[model samples]
Target: MKTTNLLMSMVIATTLFFVGCKPKDAAIQAAVQAKEATGITVAVTKGDVTLTGEVADEAAKAKAEEVAKAEKGVKTVINSLTVKPAPLPVVISEDPTLSKNVIDAVKDFPMVKATVKDGVVTLTGEIKKPALITLMQHLNALKPKKIENKLTVK
Candidate 1:
């Protein structure tokens, strides 16, 4: 009877060990699968997996989460993935490199202030002259998205 008790205890201990080990093993495996499934880089530390990288958009971020969750042993997924913003269309209007024509074009317009950032140009201020209509026509020819004309003829 003592031998049987010893055997049963050994069996129980072994089973507990296996059960404990299984989750850790599964966590590791899940991490691997998640890394493979999503091209995003994954770091697993202390049962928490952090995903990092740029994804196409919000939908892609959600898809990445789904992949991580479907894995067998992931306890928690802390997604650090960022959705890349859509690239703004390049403005050919005031490109310094494109043509000197756009440069010389704005030279005479004292009222129009042009500010360019990230390939976007913002035109602000005022203009007044019958000849200024010609100047504005030339400015519009430069191809900014839209001219914000705050000009009042004085």
Candidate 2:
């Protein structure tokens, strides 16, 4: 019984010693992912973390910093993130048929307005949140140079 107790104490002490040691990179990455900071990269060197990536928006960029800093063993957080929205496609061709087809495609959506600029299809107006995916399908079938989704969900 005495030997068993000694072994238990040793095991506990060893665990306590290493318990404070954490993988900084993995900790920061897990924290960022929990906050839905996709596309973010984390590099950790001796508890200093550097975050780099293009987030969806300014809010996402800020959240990334907050999460990285909150991670265990992170002494400092360096944020080198850029906020870049989706690129707008340049006008390739202007076709009346394209507009007509796009409009008909998303006609089920309410107050949906479609315009063709160059070869890109621009959709404006409001749609139900669920319908956005279906609308994309209909629009993609036409194969426009680019799609500008200006539609808002009601």
Candidate 3:
């Protein structure tokens, strides 16, 4: 009876020892998150860390992985972060240049009159429906800030 009791006690002691030695997932996640920048998400499961969310660039993504790996109790890091797409630059023509271009564009449509100010093109007068599309295409190619169509379409 004493031998059986001793064996049972040893098993219980071993289990507690192992459990106490392992770090909790929540604690590891908190440690990693504190060191990372904003916009990064940290998830921990059984000492494995997964990083997700959008970062500004590839360098930022790599840096986040390094941080997670460096944290204590993190067995491995899985980086699933995405890089943000760059925005397209807007092109706006200068007033003097846009004015000259607008005049040339509307010359073919005798019924259309165009005026440019502060990179904005204003169209007035009358135009046949068929020629309106062509006139607009020409003006848009010049990259004006805005186009105000006040033309009476026939």
Candidate 4:
């Protein structure tokens, strides 16, 4: 009977050791899998994982944290993932309508010159901060192929 008790105690100790000891690499691997979506980045320090970078939205950020927490050895998760603002879609188009819109949009701003070519928009000259921001929003909606942003913001 005493032998059986000693054997049982040894088994329990072994189990506890395995359960409590978790490796850092294993946690890092789990963090990688968790941050697969978007541009989220992970850092592991002493079983505490910190997630950083910008994601598409809040849900993506939350998912990353949840994944880190679910890992075997992660004692805490510090999710600092920020949601990036949506930008205008860049569609390639050589349509002359883009030029017309750009002209009409920034006609009052004499310091700016815009040229459209092969679906790409090139802006040159100096532009005021307020107008430049507004013009960009309008230009983005036009969905040009690429923007050669040479316009100096003042």
Candidate 5:
């Protein structure tokens, strides 16, 4: 009878230790799968999900939340995502002279395309002649905060 009692106690202790260790590994697996399936990388701690990485907009953010919540072991989801806005295309205004000047500037560069919207000029396309930082400096001189250059030239 004493031997049976000891075996039972040992089993109970082993079960408790295993139970304590299981959740951590389960949470890690859930986080990895959540990231792989949803494209939203997540970190799971004690079943709490932390959604991270850059997303396009709010919809992507909400979708990530839903994905993490769907995971069986997740207790709560904490969203922390950055939204990157799309660059606007270049469009000249009614004034011919000003539009022509802007066009001349782009033509001189041979790779940059500037798009003006609501007085917010977004320089898209590419630039090859000078370094990207130099081009940005010139554009910044033209307009302080209104310049959004989405050019990729190596």
Candidate 6:
């Protein structure tokens, strides 16, 4: 009976020791997350921290990792943050303004006829080889949605 009681006592003591030694993952995660910048997500499991989310730049990504590493009870830091892509510039000229500009651009090349619809300039007719380049450059400067060059170069 005494031997069985001692074995049970040992088992309970071992369990308590391990439980006390283990770090609180939730508390560590909350601490690290509070220190990090917006858009950063912090996850902690078994004292290992994983950072995930989109940051503005490389510096922000590094900063988030640093924050996680600085938190107590964090044994390892896994950085999985991604940098956000830059947005493309939008340039679309109004149809009326583009039409006026197209008319002026083709005026010097009388043989070339220009038509504008929905910010698209369509060129149909005949134009000198040398004048075609100049007319195209002028139309491109107006930032139309598209340009259809059907002019016959003579």
Q: Give the backbone clash total of model 1.
A: 0
- TM-scores, all candidates, are 0.49, 0.41, 0.65, 0.43, 0.48, 0.52
- The order by descending TM-score is 3, 6, 1, 5, 4, 2
Which digits, one per residue and each the tens of the lDDT, describe model 1 over residues 69-107?
A: 666667788888998889998656545642355457667
lDDT of 5 at 130: 59
In model 2, the runs with Cα more than 4 Å from the true position are: 1-36, 89-154
Whole-model lDDT per candidate: 0.68, 0.79, 0.93, 0.81, 0.67, 0.90
Residue 101 in model 1: lDDT: 52
Q: Which pairs of residues collide in model 3?
A: none
Model 3: per-residue Cα lDDT over 7-84, one tens digit each: 999999999999998889999999999999999999999999999999999999999999999887999999999999
- Residues 1-154, candidate 2: write the lDDT tens digits: 9999999999999998897565656766566556645588787777787888898888888888888787767789888999997899754434777877877887787578888877788888888877889889888878788999988888
- The positional error of residue 77 in candidate 5, measured at the CA in angstroms, is 1.0
Our model 6 lands, by Cα RMSD against the true structure, at 8.9
Model 1: which residue pairs collide?
none
Measured on C-alpha atoms, candidate 1 has an lDDT of 0.68
Where is model 4 more than 4 Å wrong at Cα?
A: 1-20, 25-27, 88-154
What lDDT does candidate 4 reach at residue 119?
Answer: 79
Q: What is candidate 3's CA lDDT for residue 94? A: 90
lDDT of 2: 0.79
